[model samples]
Target: MTAPFIPVNTPLLDGNEADYLAECIRTGWISSEGPFIERFEQAMAATAGRRHGIAVTNGSVALDIAVHALGLDEGSEVIIPTFTIISCAAALVRAGLVPVGVDCDAATWNMTAEGVEAAITPRTRAIMLVHIYGLPVDLDPILALARKHDLKVIEDAAEMHGQTYRGAPCGGFGDVSTFSFYPNKHVTTGEGGMILTDDDALADRLQGYRNLCFQPQQRFVHEELGWNARMTNLQAALGVAQVERLPRTVEIKRRIGRLYDEHLAGLNRIRRPVARTGYADNIYWVYGVVLNDEVPFDAKEAMRRLGEKGIGTRPFFWCMHEQPVLRRMGLMRDESHPNAEYIARRGFYLPSGLALTDDEIARSAAALKEILA
Candidate 1:
């Protein structure tokens, strides 16, 4: 008989998730305001090595809040990776800032400092560095560039919980950093996010933006508009539990990556995810594989075949330059991001969730070997 179908990602909820959630339910503190919300915020801020963490509704809104907190002018430009999710670009656009696109490094599948430097113009107000998949970007050079250019650094370390760059943590380096606690993330809150920063003023601004710009002195009088992107106490309950197990969660993800590495080593037609080097290792956010030129088909075809074999897979992010919405907005027209486009076409990640078992990983690897062969 065939084995049960494996999923792309699943949360590991064997911690204090239930107890804390029950506490919230029992206390009738299910809304955004509660003890767990503050506890989760504090834990996440400490985890990221920041002074303050303002919890938000989701990762996308976290980006929006971070962008707005930068206090850039309406037409200011922010450099971002072309290979990342649309939320990064949309956040800048929604904040009335232009998003300048840069291609990813062919090997690391991350935006390089060189690409970021090359994309800088006078209007460039900040560099929004996204730590893609679980590997932190080479941030020293980017930080240096920002210093020389007087640009703000927004670290979107959503995919890199517990992942470090050099000796320091990923989220600790930037002017402000953002994290997502989505179910697929290492530390999950079902649907929540946080903005981290050491700056006292920026943290205050973030708190204001999270709750519809409610004036402290007067309850409902608002001078500026803000979003109701507050993360609920119930979600924070899960977040608190997840944060307590972050180290173990990261280890499990790395172990999953290693398992796939061992099982898929002989497949010469596909390139496996990068391992740890002088920089941080691929925490294997997902065990992404890139099909070589010798492969007969692209990632879409490979995903279809893997699905047929009861193996779940997800395609890599499409390049922002080719996005229809951006095109309609007269942005990314006739632009070519070769590396981003190539990776988007060839890359896909397998079932690398924290909850995936050794047997599931082996079976998924076996299916890949058969399909690729």
Candidate 2:
């Protein structure tokens, strides 16, 4: 009999999650606003060491609001990594701004200060940093560069809930940070996102935008044009439950990731994920291993072999510079970023869900060893 497939990503749910849903039903305030939503936002803000969090419908909307909250004029350019989800670039475009795609650091698979410095022009308005794969991107250098250029920093902390660098929290490092509570994230709220910041003025602007640009004191009075991107009370109920269990869930993910690290660290054909000197915390959303170029087969074939063993695996995001949408929009070109392209082709993720059992991990490891051998 064939072994059951090990999925690349999965959500771990529990009775606590159900309890939140039941409470929401009992309260009968399942739509736009409720006590659970307020409580969830409060809990999340406390977790991130922030003063406030504005819940949104999804991550893309969170990014969109972050872009607009900065109050940039049309045609201002926002610098973003070429290896990020397309939403990062599209959000800037939606705000009537230009996106300047920068190359990634091969080590972290995230935007480098060098790339940002090289890409900046007089029109540059902000630096949007993405903490890819739950690994905190080195923020000091990026922040310094932003200071020198007088640009703002908006962090996409979607994949990095509770991740830390040198004892500092991920969301607190950026001027304003956004998070996603998609099912596949470290925590789940079915589908939701949040914007957090210590800046009360910025937080207030974001909250206003989230609720159809109406003043909190006056109902049905519009001051600025905004979209309806509010998170439901039902989703917030789930979020509150997940937030309570997040510390344990993150611990499990880290333990499983360390197991992968211990097993794969010494392999000649595999390049394990590297942590810089000061980054102390990571949840390892997906255990990424780069296949050394000297390896006999490329990433695609490696994935195929893993799949044949009943292991579900997939390739990483293709570099945004090479994506057809950005190219068609007349933004990127061939000579833009070779590092992003190389990492895109070489990196692939393995099964790294929090729910994977020790037996399943051992089985997956044995399959990988056999294939790589």
- List ranges where model 1 is wrong by over 4 Å: none
Cα lDDT for residue 139, candidate 2: 82
Best prediction by lDDT: 1
**Across residues 257-286, which tens digit of lDDT does each residue of candidate 1 receive?**
888999988899998877975787778788
Q: Which ranges in model 2 have alpha carbons more than 4 Å from their true place?
A: 216-218
Which candidate ranks first by TM-score, i.e. highest? Answer: 1
Q: What TM-score does candidate 2 reach?
A: 0.94
> Could you give candidate 2's per-residue lDDT for residues 1-373 as a string of tens digits?
7778899777888748788788878979899878888998898888888899999999989999988998998999888998988899889988899888888877778788888889899999999999888577778888999999899899998988878777777777678899998877887788999999999999989998998898768878887988799999999988988888888888888888888877766677777776434656557877888877788787788889989888877688888778888788787665468777876887788888778877777777777778888
Cα deviation of 150 in candidate 1 (Å)?
0.4
Residue pairs with colliding backbones in model 2 are none
Ten contiguous residues with the weakest lDDT in model 1: 276-285
Residue 70 in candidate 1 has what lDDT? 84
